[model samples]
Target: MKTHERMPELLAPAGSREKLVTAIHYGADAVYLGGANWSLRAKAGNFDRAGLRDAVTYAHQHGVKVYVTVNIFAHNRDLNGLESYLLFLRDAGADALIVADPGILLLCKETVPDMPLHLSTQANVTNKASVRFWQAQGVSRINLARELGLEELRTIRQAAPGIGLEVFVHGALCISYSGRCLLSSYMTGRNANQGDCAHPCRYSYSLLEEKRPGQYFPVEEDERGTYIFNSRDLCLLFRLPELAAAGIDSVKIEGRMKSVGYVGAAVRLYRAALDYVKERREAGAAWEEIVLPPAFADEIAKVGTRGQTENFFSSAPSSLAMLYDRMREIQPCTPVGIVRGSNPLLLETRNVLEAGDQLEYLGRRLEPETCTVRAMSAADGVPLQRANPGSLILLTVDPPLADGAEVNALFRKQHDRQAE
Candidate 1:
């Protein structure tokens, strides 16, 4: 792969401090995030002044690159304060700034001329001339719009030989044109232009004619109506060969307001996949067995993903599950007791117990689950609390459970956001 003259980068999103670390540790070649202002995900937990500095330092320590977002459509009022923000980004250690507004791009180049300017996908860069224009204006990269077909990108690459091209390989998609819709403002007076989108497109709607006041018609699916105006999530994990051969520079994932688990799982999977292709080129063959395993990505799917679909790369994907709700939280069962000694496992139970209740620890690693509780014993040498929710339970594990490991005799209600 080294001789293949290709070093495709696996770029991931890092919305929080912990997420950035997770990306680097799990394996992201680079990361992108939004700062306080001028970012598409203004509602996301963007970095404060101190966090950006820390994030840059941590990523570089692990040899990962960082890109900050300056990509929101800016207003005249927004234009006045960007210089200080640019200076802060420059000194705080940003490798590049992804910009959508032409004026913002120009200002970024003029102010932080040393930093690499990446044209945002919002620029709708579908032609060679625009690519060349941005390149001349000092853009080191162009995040091509998702609306373009792969062949269109090939033509753009051939025409603008000098400009580097980046495209989103995975994550959410909008029903609008290249993700630049004004429907939110038109519907709810929430300005998407100023970044307070109401996401009216995601809502299910019914149409009614003026002649028929009470009669309504379903838009797409008649049953309960559909996820109309809802597009599927994009995934290109299996299409690595085509993407690598496409002559693009970086393959980016689009999720900034997502969780750390999501960032780690998806980034690790793609990072492994990217390395798989890289290794194939280096070793001159595919091991097939050694390439990225679906099991890895599956573990991430358990962390609440929209499920994977290969959206519109080679062909359109089937329907995707809706994005996970960040607010609908998953709470852990409170730890009540810990294993104290090694007899029939001398243990202290939080709640009252009989004798035999299936013991469980917060086992996370290994098969069948190490923390998964199965066996049980009693501190009094009598075991019988076989079925219970809260009890000072002593459950024996296949492999002796850790002494300090948390034991659960209680079951808490778990709900999937969409399922609920």
Candidate 2:
């Protein structure tokens, strides 16, 4: 195998402390999170001041970097404690700040001049000129607009080879231009730019003519209303070699509002893909000739999705990118429990777990293992036929967990398969 200096960083989202831990254990090189204020994911389990401090500490102990989002488009009233918050983040040992608004950028430069800054994707940086402009402004890294294609990214990287570039490699896509949309604010009174979006784009809609009161017409023939603006989720697992050859510095997974299972599964799969690409590259394989294992996509399908699309990665997206028939693809598997302890085999149930049922355990560095629920009881040893969501139960398995299954490992059960 040939040698390269570094692999692209696998950046993951951490909506809360548990999610942060899961991302780290699943092999993320860095984690991005939102503080209690100034983050776009106001609905996520953001951290408080004390929590922010502790989160940074914990991530650093695990050799992971933490970038706090202060990327809201601000108003005059929103600037109330802005300076103090900037100082607090700097003092809290945050690695960098992700900012979108120019006012906040200037404030971060003035208030915490020594701290590093990363331009957020919400800034809509689509061209090489925009990349150079931000680079000149003391920005260390820029997450380019998601709408760019692979060739465009290569062009930008060639234009400015000094600065770092990042792109979203997985998760949801927005219909609007670079996630700046007024539909949420106009319809739901929540400003997306200010970080309180209600996701009106995902809502179902039908046409209502002025003359025909109480009459609704479907945009499509389905009984359920049409989803005109719903875009498919992005999955670029197979394109890692191309991205690495393009000199992209980081590949990010985008789900601050998603579940811990989603975070763990995504980070683990992507980590394996990136490593696979690196090894193939080192072995003198051309980027175009590298093919990822098919199981990567099959395993990722276990997590819920609206169907996958390349979205503008290779060329302009077609109408096929929209999910007109349904809101989400039927998930192939459901998370059933989380391993809380291994000594007595304590399991925290996320879904119903019953005796004689088969379960698949998602471990840290190995392929998922299948096991059977031989017996289970309450935490105090009383027998139970089944365990409901949120219950902690002691379990015995037909095939005991392998050597390294630790706390927080996730377990899932496959849904009954149907003929296509």
Candidate 3:
């Protein structure tokens, strides 16, 4: 049994202020988010200057670190306010900056010399030499490329033990190398490098003969047209023990544009898994002997995904990594509402909620409690049979909520069929 010196930090994504709160509530050690500009997720509900400052303070108050993303590949036009933004982030007390472009890295070094820098995986850091080079440039951490296998990761960790090593333990797997794709630019005039990706890789393709201009043929891989470039979502919940043993410093969940439910669920599940591993290790359990409970993976499947894949973790991935049939898996559970107020037990509906529905409230520490909806009413106390999205409804459950069910605790209900 290989013993790690310390437990790896469980990092989660925060696309918005709400998501940030959710991540922290679910026990993330750190969260990575983007600002209004210069972020790879430009379409996300990113923070402005004021919002960034507030987010930093709020996260710090809760004892969680905040890393801001300035990770877009910059063009001449994109460099206008780069220096000012970097300075602003530094002043806002950001724990670190995640950067991908070499020019951005150089500018950060010059502008915010005291600020910690983390090299983004978009930099395609696959080898130990790249890690060493980045470390030489004052990078405190480096998120390794997603294309590397577990053996390659072990070798890289062995070569560069000084710098903090992080990897995407879960989330959508990009078809291109570390998310540097040109397909969006070529197809929709949106450059992925500049962060306005249209996700052309997820678009289905069909065969069209040049000679027969109007003839369209199905490019079928399995009856669902050819989705050649759509890769499955990555899930490493079962592999946490191995990653910790291999000297990985952080495990990241990759979804800044995902919903609050996704953020909370992923963070909660990973937090529990890491804790389980830590407890076992403290009891002198062998790494090979430690096995995570099946509920961890089962809970993760409730969140939306293209499909689950290990990606390039164990070895070179095959065609099985690509979701050739569908864009995303049919989620087994849908996030129905969020606990808005604990006093009256108010819930702000995210999806439709009916009177007779049963919901599973995701409790802190991953101990979910199920309750049957006995009755529903509007905020104004109007009786209702069904509550639509965005409605603030009052719910009466058979088994009442336990004491200390925190506000913003997510609630979900199972679908009619199982998620594939």
Give the count of colliding residue pairs in each prediction: 17, 1, 0
Q: List, residue by residue over 31-54, the lDDT tens digit for candidate 3.
A: 999998899998989998899999
TM agreement with the true structure for every prediction: 0.74, 0.96, 0.96
Query: What lDDT does each candidate get?
Result: 0.68, 0.89, 0.89
Q: Give the poorly placed runs of model 2, Cα more than 4 Å off.
A: 1-4, 416-420
- Give residue 2's error in model 1 in angstroms: 5.0
Candidate 2, residue 90: lDDT: 95
Candidate 1 segments whose C-alpha is farther than 4 A from its true place: 2-4, 211-217, 220-223, 286-309, 315-419
Residue range with the least summed lDDT across 10 consecutive positions in model 2: 411-420
| Per-residue lDDT of model 2, residues 361-398, tens digit only | 89855368888999999999999989999999999987
Question: Which parts of model 3 have CA positions greater than 4 angstroms off?
Answer: 1-4, 221-223, 416-420
